[model samples]
Target chain A: MKQRNEQLPPGIRGFLIRMGQIDRRWIYLAVAVAIAAPMLARLRFPEVPGRMAQATFDAIESIPPGSRVLIAYDFDPASAAELEPMANAVLHHCASKGHRIALMALWPLGKQLADDAIRDILLEYHPEKVEGVDYVQLGFKTGNEGVIKLMSTSIAEAYAADASGKPITQIPLLEGVRTIGDFQLIASISAGTPGAQQWVQYGDSAMPDAFKFVAGTTGVQSSQLLPYYPKQMEGMLIAIKGAAEYEMLVTEKYPVTRSADRLALGRERMGPQFVAHLLLIGLIVLGNVSMLAARGWKGAAR
Target chain B: MSADRAQQSSGAPKSDTRLWIALLIFGAVGIFAGKLWRPGPLAEAYVEVVTETRVLAEVVPAPTTQGTSTDVQSAETVAPTSLEQENAPTTRVWVELDDPRFKSGELRRVEGVATEVWDERAKVDPKKAREQIAALESDAEKLSAPTDPTGLTREEFEAREAARMNALKVVESTRIVASPRDSIGIWIAALLTLGIFSFLVRDNPFYKVVESILIGVSAAYWMLVAFWSTLVPDLFAKLAPDLVRATMLPGLAPSEHPGKDFLLALIPLALGMMLLWRLAPRGAWIAVWPLAVVIGTFAGMRLTASIEADFMAQIAATMKPLVAYTSSSAEGAAAGSAFDLGGTLAGILGVVGVITVLVYFFFSLEHKGVVGKTARVGVWFLMITFGAAFGFTVMGRITLLVGRFDFLFNDWLGLSP
Candidate 1:
């Protein structure tokens, strides 16, 4: 019965079908243009740092120099674009502060994320720093919160060795450390399940007084983390806006001294976002105008 | 999975039992062959055990004479010291010895060497405290003697350390690290992977597992959380405090007696548990009273927060700057650190968008005159918003797909590293 609606004039019928249903690829094409146009032109837009992102930057800044901070690359390569900027900005901020980091990952590919960060930022830029003492990569273990729970009790039991199979006992940075609580601060940069919410609910909530925690989350997952913020979570960075804001804060205060700048990524992306938002608004208005014209002028045609 | 449907259609069920049997047999044989076939890596041990035991001699709270405390945890390696050396009064001196395990078993039998140092302040008069300690040492020396140890003296010490490690096992579980949860390899886990994704098609048993996994995950989270959050902090940290206060000074804000408070706490706890009675066929309706307060409070909180956080706050933020329409104002040129031209436009559009969206959802009020037209406009705005949101989400997914393609084509193929 609904198939009868398929037969109509091209533009008018297209409008009608769009109002109800339409080819998804057309929408994809529109989105691609919306994104690519700004990128091709190398659009630049100004961004005012959001309060939450500022809070995240400030929280990391407040840590004393030489303090141990664990950065959990809890997301896989899938969310690299949305989350990598935040992670990069955070790494720069921590390195700028001279905070010792013990990099680790909950997701397997997260280790690769750490490796990429190390290769891109750490290995080339900060070549003077020593591993196993200055900063360590504890690598990855195969237990979700089970590992969290284990490390909380006894880190040695949970992880006896580093990713390279060297005993953790040999790592000078991990000396006298018993659990996640030993770290001066912990940051979970993640996307979805086993991400920020898991960190907040499982890790932070378990021992609120033990360690300070902050999260970098995707936009969809941000609202869920909000309830735990300020009290449970010291700070939270949400999606592109959050990343952009955080980048602005970190760069303005403690600028990086190399290529692959963070502030530019966030600000560059914001230009496309602003333009895309405008385009979307226009589309809605046009659709409404078309609806009005079709209804009102039908009598004139008759 | 659809054997019954197939039976009805074809007058017989597909004989897939043979396939299952074949798979089981093949898997078992494959595992056995692999075990027998695989070669082991050739490598030398990186770590070598040095001293197998150390005597925890005089461990003073603050004595400069004592050398640093090494692994004196395993007491036995202390050489018999002269009166001058023993009476030097150091904090904690871990005496060195040869790898005692390689030596005679008698080398492992160091006993009654105090592994703990309380405080130097506790010994106000060292001479007198030493006398008292010597007297107590005689008594404790006897007490330290094993009535019936399960093994040799060395084994007893090993057992003690092992027990200490075991007691610490619970605290070990509370650790938060970025551990890989790479459970069931990518290919072998297709059952759960496909089962979870099955919901995109329709709800069924496959979908049920996915839904149940969500609940199971939540339940497991709370189970671990409750122990560390409530049991450890509340019960462990407060164990001594709860006792000391009740014994020394009564009449505190919360009762110092954990035992009594614990009993009183059970009233609400039991009442909370009673709500689960609804799971039963009979007497299920009895759970309403218990659930009433829970449901009511939940509704109250949800409504109060949603209206304020979502509706009112958003509406208030949507208001345009006065300079948006006022060309004479300085605010016309700058808004929120960006040039005001775009910001002003965005603000005005946001307000109109919000109003239109609300009009669309306003089903209670009948459409009339401008209302019908305004509501129609609202629907268009909402549809556009949904479309935009969907498009953005798809873009994000496509980014992930592209990343996977990049991994396969670039990283693995060494084309893009």
Candidate 2:
């Protein structure tokens, strides 16, 4: 045979190089299967909600009925999937409790989130609640935390009208509202600061007992925020679990009146969540195992 | 990336004509949205009415809990509407504080109430509020001024600002809005900002030392969070404030309670001040005494909480649920429940895979044994997580870049805007 330079021994090369180069699409498929199978099968993993989620739920629940509650929407489309349910649930619970809600946004895009939440949840569920009275949307303001600090004392300085350009003074819900402390409680569903921490710092810290406050945050942020829970923060809901737990709380006692399906949207999403969490965990382990196998074969070859 | 390819991409620019067309569309929307963003008459009246209703709702039981979309989307920050947009009888910055929905009379009342509070706060602590009002009012004036000192000499502008600052009225003391809460918040805000600033000094021992102090302070903060968030709500909200006062301190005045108002502020305050000493040469040595005490307390508390919340609790949750083993099938349904067996299995497998991958990290032990071989297998699993994380992180970074690009290309020159 003509001399040829083969890369390596055929069998060894096949195992080490050929097999090792598994297509990423296969992994994606595996992930899809891993996630979908559970939903199809209805796998029920025993999970008790974490304390942070419970605290968050309880914070919303604990405020005296009919108290003034300020809910700041601070996320965009990307975070809507994870945050919307809790945001909706929070709005639902507050509305149901007859709490006056002062709605506003911190992010430019956050306004859309507020608008979407209002259109989908409020109008659909609580049509009896009138705008500027049962609730008022101060719309979007651009000052970041400086707004919080200023509005802590002077609402007129920061906001004079609802998002539609209506004067807030006419709104029945915001009648006496002069400062951040005027509200009995502030519940911020935030992806990050100038959202949660800002409220805790500039909002809560500014007023102290003026209002009880809490937040709903993503899991990655929960670790950082854990220290704030139950103290500086009256309650905290961490990620999907927190959302699900809060959803359960709102729906349990006071269910959404309009859409029978609305109550369970968050819990329903948990199906995908469980699958996603498991998928990430699986990917982590599989990647580790493959490395070990590759290393072992390399060492043995030597 | 290539010109042809760029053109093929729908959003990419093609020719000058197309560019102009796009710009026209973008400009129209931006101007309209930007201009009309100012709250109008009808909207102003609506919000005023809503405020009154909310006032009553505060007294009733369970005020409507459902959040509204229009309300939620309304504000991003509380900063007053910008100076530029606030010009004349009406203008638009990123926000609008004036609207026509309310009778001018109603708005005047709202503004009057606000001014009353400010004036009251100023009266109580004239000295402090004077500074705050002066700092803000002058800034507002300068920013809003029509002339802008456009061609003024640098020294002149400085002199103008200084003269303005000097003209600011000061009194002995004003306690109206200057509550202990305000003081604590301001103080803490200053410290937090400074603490973050210290990090910018780089790796000097002075910086590291301050960082360590912050960590230690943060740890103490963790305890306070736990105690106040968990214990207080569970306790205080349930019990009488009087009971806490009697039991904890006996004859505890309103000011003495741990959570009473803003009393616990000293915990963060004294420690924060001590941290500042690290920057000063002489006080550096003694600064550590306070640092040690806080560090020790934080370390001890963190140890317990970390174990209970993170480690032990996590391990406990990991055990396969009873239903997983009983109901799981390859087909995967044990229906009616939200829990998914396949997902749980994936989790369980992930856990196992992690153990194997960890073995790969240890190169010390010879792979002659089965354990060593498994360890080698484990390393592969770890890479997958890194890859995923890398991909996700990259996506996040790219999004930021896209935002910057949007600002430059679209927002700035209105050229491709």
Candidate 3:
């Protein structure tokens, strides 16, 4: 290693070492440029839906039209950047398929996110849908999995009234609903605990065959949820990439006439994602090269 | 010492000059960039349409001597004697047109007054309610009869009954309207985001101030949310439904077993009060009891839930056939080539990883010879898993950063195309 380094030009070796020792602020600046530049350019790439994305799409599609679907917004604004796109996409997909939707939340702020989806996606695209007849908002419950357990037995007991304070019994959509089992499909867009995991445990385990279960989780939470995929979870969407792929499949099947940009949030975000990943790969390569060069330098000195 | 002091003095101004130059250059670049990347028009301002309305005054009269009497039928039949006069002043209220009651005709518009009112005349009278309940019961009985004429199923009859019961419950009508968006909020958010990013340059007062505000605001927000969403609804409503409905939640549904619910709610209320007693000057030790109870109950609940959900479920999922075969099509059944090589390899890999990881954690025996090799393999698997987790964490973090930038550009500056 020493002989090899001695044969190489000192200027090149010194340059590599200097690059390694460069200020971290410069690296931050580089990353910023890499992300911001691509975003400003409106760069976009076509997404080919993968197996997981396909599974998620199929899960919702397999259910008959007008079948009741419960979407648990288990994420808050903190993870909205990652999960909101998928939430919007899923809501649109379900509504487009004419599924009678029920929205609930585990996290306190999750209700707000659900409300945003209702306002932005559901109401915007499907204005003809009546509130009580076509859909309902169950809102947030205090008990985490306990709520799920209660719902598994009886939804009315779990939620006496909807988010608007309308009695669950009075809601035309919930008339025939006895329990969580009444829903044809259940999807949980989750960030952490008391989320998809809790749903799988308390909700799915109670009546495994009653309804199909699917989940959309943040990248970090995906590892924890991976074990439940293909079985407990009939479908799974992991992070922004998953969101983008799912969004593509959804929009392809059910294209919106107005405000198409709303559904394109995930794909638009993928531009910065591509550049950031490339920058990361570049930094990793640079760091490794620097390490090798320094090692050779040390050997030559010895 | 004099020479060293001179060198330090000379270096100080040089560093200061360099800092000033850097600041100047960055500021110039930022200004020029902002100009070059012109933003789109500001978001349109939305207005909430609030309409004035009148709601029925929810004034329950005091019980009369006749009402207190043990004659259940009499109590059910007689109207309250102290009912308020019809000439009582109506209060003015503003409700959003979006309220469901407006659509349901529960809140009807006063034609001349140009405001909606909850008709006091439409209030459910005690006698009428009894009659309605009796009628529903008779209808339900007919549906349940051996030779049921009504085609309605048992569930459908029950659902109608439930709806009737819900309608009979007395609830106060109230107004609700959303707060309009303000520019002040947007500016504050943008400044705070920038302040946070300023930390990358160096620690400064702006970053510290932003950090403190974020912490304080988040804590206060969480506390308020918990109080209103959890404690009030779950605890107070159960304990004192009428009071909660009257004051905080006008829409709180009537409970069937109020007595049982109150008794059950009292246990938690007592525990909560004890927990809060730690803030007092005396009997701080009382808090420990509730804490212990909470921890014990939580542990017990989590233990059972984890065992059933995580342990058993995961084991069931992982115990798969080592050799996975492709589902043969009707025509392909005779071909004798339905082997799914990829799935089989994945299954085998999963089994190997699980076994090796278990071997690594087995500290009962000394890790030597075959055990050492297996443990090493386990370490490799563990490393791979960790690397994947780390990559995911990084990806999630970057996405968050991207989100913040998206807000700054699209929302704040409207820079993105």
Each model's DockQ score: 0.09, 0.05, 0.66
Question: Which residue runs of candidate 1 sit more than 4 Å off their true CA positions?
Answer: A1-27, A205-210, A261-263, A298-302, B1-417
Specify the highest-TM-score model's number. Answer: 3
Off by over 4 Å in 3: A1-9, A167-175, A205-211, B1-46, B49-52, B55-181, B229-308, B329-341, B364-366
Model 1 DockQ (Cα-based): 0.09
The sequence of per-residue lDDT tens digits that candidate 3 reaches over residues A26-52 is 788788887777777778888889899
Model 3 chain A, poorest ten-residue lDDT window?
A1-10
- Candidate 2, residue A11: the lDDT equals 62
Residue B196 accuracy (lDDT) in model 3: 91
For residues A66-182, what per-residue lDDT tens digits would candidate 1 score against the true structure?
A: 889989898886688778878888877887788888888888789878877775666545677788877888777767767676776777887888777667888988888887788
Sorted on TM-score, highest at the top, how do the candidates line up? 3, 1, 2
lDDT of 3 by residue, B1-417 (tens): 577557645643455447745874885588458747774443211222333544322122224534321211112122233465445433222344455545544344434544454322222322233455566556655544343328889888778766655544311121121123534455678889888987776555678799999999999999998899889998999988878876898657678899999999999999989999999999899999999999999999999989997788768878989987786666564465578899899999999998998899998968899999999999999999999998888767878988888777765664644
| Model 3 chain B poorest 10 in a row by lDDT | B170-179
Angstrom error of the Cα, residue A264, model 3: value is 0.7
Model 1 has an lDDT value of 0.62
Q: lDDT score of model 2?
A: 0.60
Q: Model 2, B314-413: lDDT tens per residue?
A: 6665565433443445565555346657767877776787568667766787766897778766766767766655543432332232333222222222
